[model samples]
Target: MGMGGMRRQGSDFEPEFFRIFRSIEDQQKRSAWLQAEGMLAAAPMLRARGLPLAADDPGEVSLEAERAAAEQQMLEALVRSGVPFLLAGPSLAAWTLYPEPGRRPRESMDLMIHARAVNDARAILRDEDFVPDPRGATRTESAQAWRRSKASVQLSIRLRWDFCDHPILNRRFSIAGLQAKSVVIEKPVAGLRALGVEHATLYSALRWVDAVHERFRLVDLFDQDLRWRMLGKEKLAELALLARQRGVAGILAEHLGMARRVFGTPVSTELLHSLKQSGNHERSGSLLGAGRGRMRYHLLGALYGRGLRVRGRHLFSLISPG
Candidate 1:
């Protein structure tokens, strides 16, 4: 209980997610902002207060409908062509991870497949009018931007052969290992699957820590608390080992501490202590006690060579926000 209390007394690196969330004093305006940004990850909390949502414009609703239909067509094409894949990211997670999903609309959806079958999968998407994003290859996988030839489907599909897109970070997890633990989807979207609970916990933690943002990714970070709760105690013992083995224990532990600090995620006190005590550099107050910015740029860089280019890209964006 002592450890579970927020660790940072006065840290400048603290996330402003809830600070900004609470600052939105008017419930009406807050709901509108959430809807416009498609940050439906906050739906359960909003519903608890019985807040009325700002309605969508009819044009936007029509566009969303078209996108949904296009997405379904893309999925049907994949299934019909027998392209085995796993539905990933917020597209599925947002819909299924929480007690009541808000079906957050996505301009892009992610799916993973075997490297050998990437072309085959692309062909199926092409047949359905999707085309390779002209922006070209990613560090880890190819992308298929949904062709907005007529109605502006407002969709992009990522064809991933691996989970972590970072070249340096690719060693963290495996497509094969995650796929082995994947759970099948049965309704609304058939022939699709998502990461299992243990995997979701790790993946979400990784994303939380690895992410670099101008504005804190409020919805995704909010997801950390939810997924952490879903993880429960039975498998709690394995998370530290998994995090350690995958080389993310220190960084993930640090971010988990941040989550506990910020969100009051309702995880057991022992969890944070266990992660820090997992016998990584975390125990030495190296990564675990570091500030969020320091941990992101320095600890992760030294551990996995992740920061130089990423930091440069972020700086460039800051300098040129056009």
Candidate 2:
């Protein structure tokens, strides 16, 4: 359902705020402030109304446990090697939503590391024959090749190939002021494992760009929040503002929306307000009008246009005075 249909009653932030945030003009600054206000405002109102927010619930907690289990092993391995890495994309999301792996994974553990580290990771996995694709061609070509090979390998296990050598991969991995810190993931049978945070956050956001067709997963956002929390809300607010200035508010918003939809929680209002202020509403909307495949593409484009800006900001940050 659209944002309007998704609103649960008693939410202090009006659903309209989201709709407007999706389609506003020149109020990137204003929307962001309002978003923060709404979030701060929501807490008391929600408390007064006795409404429950989904930050930590049983199902979510269970899922996090499963994700944690799956992640710790991989992380501990990376840490042992002294790899300069960070958790990015689905893995972080899964970790946030469910800190341990379950009987099954909602999504594979995706990690983002400096470009220099890809070969290192590939080397580690190579003993198991998990080598990186050497097509040296565009991702589209690789995806096609993978599809052709799908008959031989389990499609899901092989899906990781499509993710290799992605253009966005570079941006997320080589972000300015990039840093790493360890997070613990639990393995029911194996004790604890360690993973990097910075890389994981970038990867998770980048994953949203490609996983356009997959079912929206809320756990990712929960992870984003957790990653953001680890990174510090101050940085999130700074990035949110920077993302807007770069014209990526729409992209960030869409991803934030996906997080809300999947996880049943809103992204930080402060971050939202910052993005809204950055996004010029006059230019936002369903650019493709209406069509079958077009809806996703249109929405994706609106978001990407904004994302390019955010990415651009990161690019600039990488070089700017610290």
Candidate 3:
């Protein structure tokens, strides 16, 4: 779902405020503010509304347990329905890449499925009482999401499930490719599948680029930085090769460069040089380059790329209180 459509009913800040915050040039200040807001403000606000703040927060322990149970239940349901899926995004990151506990409390769980199975997946979710989130939905895309909730501590806590038929980064990498490249995680949640660290790294980088055009979230940068730190140099070389094979080498390089600039991510110089030498970095480099290079042009282009209907919907949502 676009950030434009992701308003919480009781949020103190408008969704547009988040979009503006992302455009702030000061990375350190933005990260610090985000950390403070997440801990002192967003967590309490969400917890008061019966949302899970973090897996390790004492006040929200019950909510965390319920979320875990709900995730397992949903996974078991999908397994019974015979739908093939791999959990993606922050949920996977929390389990594998992220180092600290409760560091990233995801608001939703992202699932990737083959395009042909989307209807089946939707049916399964509906069977479990998940309803479509119209505010965050579009009719044409191969992506759809639903939300399910149960009463908790006088209010209700919600779990969101996002189903995507295409790779989260570039649509060119097919679901079959993702499935073939996925790795299995057996503990904490058995039979769980996730993208390999190399592929996941590339996805994280592309996701950062997406944030550059849409809404910037510090968590996105942190995910890349932490994952890069964990994956180290050899894995990055593998990621570079995978990006080349997937035809997203330039895009990968461009975002990696951005991560270095914005968060001081430690991408190896050799990998950067290798990617640039491949001659595929020009398109994304021109569009999402660091500092003052063509970012405004690209942002405008991205706004236009969302099309009139989506843009109008966002504007309308921004202005309407409901």
Candidate 4:
């Protein structure tokens, strides 16, 4: 079919799709979703839980400076500890794909370390004065907090370090597999590092599916938008194939469909149609319901439970306030 005809056929639910897309794009809706998920506060919110910010100087400039210092210290500590690791999450996103100044600055840095080196890395973090936040962390134990010093910003900055070999959506993704497929590149500020754009993109898509299935969050949708913009037709084709191989074709197709309809994200019409044909019809219906509200999406998740395999514990971690 021609591209125009294909777009029409592919977007049969455009009205409902865009409605949901715009809702997620709305800042108020996004904030409400983050607040509901308990991720809205990075460090300042943790003050009540004993990890106080620089109470005397809580200005944005101070906070930004502290965060920058903390990130540099954390990276230095990781290197000093001799632990093999790769940067992921928003920091990496900023480094590689989305360089928009208006994009929200990440609250923490996410690092994936070799499984065997996790203990050593943890020890290094502890020596650096970093401690576990234990707020929203569940299956994968992510470390947070450094020290409570006025000079160091009082442990306000947080870092999440996870073992490279871990389960995402209940599926195992090994570090070796990641390293083999990841694109190695040099960062202007951070030097040479592995940029797992493909893996990160796929992971973001899966996270978005989980958000729809559990609680609707704007950050997840925003992440999808960022990663989607970073990828091209070749990369997306590879990602689609990876999702199929990883048993997440339905989930990928559903979110890609939503992104295409809402953000006008670039996705091949042919690719979308093929994925939809191979994916679950139930999920397609759920995606349509998701644009309406949380209740509809939850009902669909309860009814279908197909497409992606999100562990019960993982689902709890996504929704639970940490």
Candidate 5:
């Protein structure tokens, strides 16, 4: 189902927000889960509407300062190690959403750095006591035990990836490529770096499609919506052109439509119409559109990519298996 069809009656967030909310029968368990997701602030609103509530719910505890310090520590370590990185996904989104992470806490910070720096980044994070949770079988992990599911966003494992969703998306896109074409945004923290208006907007849409198609997580849509609202019309025009150049504008338009419909985010309708006009050139709807088997994701990838090269490069991306 598209996001609209997935909504349960009471959820103001993603449908899985309520799907997981309703699944827990115990009040404190629900409260704890909400606290962990950073949604405990909604407790009063939910209770006023006569939903279940725990009378003894704890006082609001903000994790922003602590998270900021931890993020600073890790980034400093990476920079010291000479590894260039981009604060990616939730970590990148946190800069604008500062002092409030909205409905979900960034249980893990995301980093997408040069492919050459993966091992060094992994080691630096480990030295800082950030345990690396390396996952490669995106093509093989089961649905019920899928580690990235909405219900299991945090497993008390405190897991973090050395590279931001790299195993899944880095296979398709690259940090160096993004850095080459992208403008840099202001560093939120001392060592923090990210793509500026144009590139950040493009990448977030790309990630949004991958996350939703895999049924992996709704939080990514929140990230995309965050980027969309920050990029006003002119920059978005730049994004639309960049996306078409990248061959993802068509599929991105459809997913951006989902972000708009669900979050009431201010994505331009005219821009979306322009994006959809790409038609056959848009690669994702055929390549990674939802429900295709894993084998097809690998096969179709070789057929096209942003800024196509000779077939050999595409074939290398398919078989090299990051």
Candidate 6:
């Protein structure tokens, strides 16, 4: 989560620069101002609920600055921690395109943990005062939590099944493999950070890039593209080899296609055919409906051909074109 090349420079100071910056183009500055106003507007609500806004809260002007700094510190801390994590959502965006602090980050700090270690991670978080979400009826389900501090810093935790860590894929990874790819950062929050390329590549292939999923997130594709572009061919090959060894050849193949489509780098045909012949097909389409199931063949074929880009606003726009 250290600063990526996308951080905004002094030239982005103009309000108009934010307007065309994609996420903030339309109502970016307005949204930031709204958040400032909302904080101020909530005073009545807080008072009605016996939680009056502090008179010495430094008013809206200072409050925004304070909130931004607090969030930045938390991000720094996350980067410093040695825990395996990746910047997802708006955090990644902010890191990539250096946005103004007043522009609220849209995504939270999302970290991936092996499903098997979820219990252990939850235990660690609980000790830090993160209680499990009680919204669901079942108590013994997958773990999740959200916590906030008096300073207005927010934290969220979710335990999910990592598509790359599947038994099939794990078998081929080297001793250090994904574990060796982590880096330690010292900002926003300190923690272990994984290679953004690997994280984004795996994420797009497993979930976002596939035609089977309906969720269209151009940001995810763009993030993967950015990371992949930053990662030269050698690193991409190493990742491909790692995936192939893990028996997730198919996923990696698809990932390469996604990289080519979104980032404009074509993956080899040999790699594509190889993965299709290696991975388990049953687990691939379990979540997709029939239409999506049909879409895969076409997408796969197209991947073998020209490949697609992350741009455009079609159904495939939400997903990686390959």
- Per-candidate Cα lDDT values, in order, are 0.58, 0.42, 0.55, 0.51, 0.52, 0.42
Candidate 6 stretches with Cα past 4 Å from truth are 1-72, 75-105, 113-155, 159-177, 186-192, 209-214, 255-322
Compute the lDDT for candidate 3.
0.55
| C-alpha RMSD by candidate, in order | 6.2, 12.9, 10.6, 10.2, 8.1, 13.7
Q: Give TM per candidate.
A: 0.72, 0.49, 0.65, 0.61, 0.63, 0.48
Question: Cα deviation in Å at residue 37, candidate 2?
Answer: 31
- Tens digits of per-residue lDDT for model 5 on 1-322? 2454322223354344455677899877887776654556445534654557665233353344455455555566766677776655566666554434333345555555665666666565556544434442222211011122232123212222321222233334556665565444455445456666565665666555444224344555656766776676677777777667767777677777766665556666676777888835644556444554444554554443333442344455456645
Report the CA-based lDDT of candidate 6 relative to the real structure: 0.42
Error of model 6, residue 36, in angstroms: 21
lDDT of 2 by residue, 127-177 (tens): 333434333122222121111122222211122222322332323223223
Candidate with better lDDT, 1 vs 2: 1
Tens digit per residue, CA lDDT, model 1, 1-322: 0233455434453334455556688976776666665554445464554444444445544555566676666677677777778777666665575443334555466787777788888777777667666542332232334443344556778776766644345556677777887887764467667777666766666555433432344456566666776775666667767777766665566667656666656555566666666636433233234365422433344444345664454344344422
Q: Which stretches of candidate 1 lie over 4 Å from their true place?
A: 1-20, 27-29, 32-37, 40-45, 49-69, 98-102, 134-150, 209-216, 282-322
Model 1, residue 264: what's the lDDT?
Answer: 57
Which of the two candidates, 4 or 5, achieves a greater TM-score against the reference? Answer: 5
Q: Model 3: per-residue lDDT, tens digit, 28-119?
A: 56545555433322344334435333433454444544565666677777766778887777667766753332445555666777767877
**Model 6: per-residue lDDT, tens digit, 16-50?**
21222234444446334334323232233224434
lDDT of 4 by residue, 1-322 (tens): 0112224435344533234424576665654544443234333322433432333223443454455555666666666556777676655664555332113345556666555776777677667666665542433333343342334454333333432212334333566566566664554334435547778876566545433323443444556665887777788778877777765676677677666654456666778778766666433434433264444444444443333442343444345453
How accurate locally is residue 320 in candidate 6, as Cα lDDT from 0 to 100?
Answer: 44
Best-to-worst ranking by lDDT: 1, 3, 5, 4, 6, 2
Measured with C-alpha atoms, the lDDT of residue 208 in candidate 3 is 53
- Residue 279's lDDT within candidate 5 is 34
Distance from true position, residue 133, model 1, in Å?
A: 2.2
Better of 1 and 5 by lDDT: 1
In model 6, the worst 10-residue window by lDDT is: 1-10
Top candidate by lDDT: 1
- Residue-pair clashes per candidate, as listed? 0, 43, 0, 3, 0, 42
